[model samples]
Target: MIAATRELPAAGYAPEVDGRLKAEFTTRLRQAGGEELKRRFPMLRIRIYDAQTHAREEI
Candidate 1:
């Protein structure tokens, strides 16, 4: 996902893209929850914050 994030030249991105990526990441994280990687991806909730505007979103 770093590659996709790097494609943008800013601190933020499109809400739709962010939403899609968040869903995909969350799914993959849950699917790969093996004993070896336990506690590695503790994503109980997903949130995105805009530091410039002080806005936050829970997805």
Candidate 2:
């Protein structure tokens, strides 16, 4: 599991926020493909956790 900690926006955890984050993660993963990501991280799961709300989202 890859846990990413982000400061909540003023508007908070909206659906769009999750979508944007997922897209950004995908882009970064692709950019870090092959040895860069696979050999180092080897993670296939992505998750977001909001400490304040105890909220979690699986991407």
Candidate 3:
């Protein structure tokens, strides 16, 4: 698994906040042909985790 950590402001820990990051990341990935890359490498996945709440979501 690939893991990343970022220190966010209190309000930045909300789902909408994280979701926006996910959306933007996904958009950039897709623009860079992430779909084709994923097809070639099926194990690739993007996930988000909240450190404060210890919550996780796959995007």
RMSD of 1: 10.2
What is the per-residue lDDT of model 3 for residues 1-59, given as tens digits with 9 covering 90 to 100?
A: 96664444333222223233332231223424444645676775734445455564454
| Cα lDDT tens digits for candidate 2, 1-59 | 98776444432332223233332222223333323433465564444434346465554
Q: How many residue pairs clash in each candidate?
A: 0, 0, 0
Backbone clashes counted, model 2: 0
After TM-score superposition, what is the CA distance of residue 36 in candidate 2 from its true location, in Å? 14
| Candidate 3 Cα misplacement greater than 4 A, ranges | 1-43
> TM-scores of all models?
0.27, 0.27, 0.28
Q: Please, what is the whole-model Cα lDDT of each candidate in the order they appear?
A: 0.35, 0.39, 0.41
Cα error, residue 1 of model 1, in Å, equals 33
List the lowest-lDDT window of 10 residues for candidate 2.
22-31
For model 3 the local lDDT of residue 29 reads 37
Indicate whether candidate 2 or candidate 3 has the larger lDDT.
3
Candidate 2 backbone collisions, by pair: none
| Rank list by lDDT | 3, 2, 1
In terms of lDDT, the poorest run of 10 residues in model 1 is 22-31
Error of 3 at 40 (Å): 11
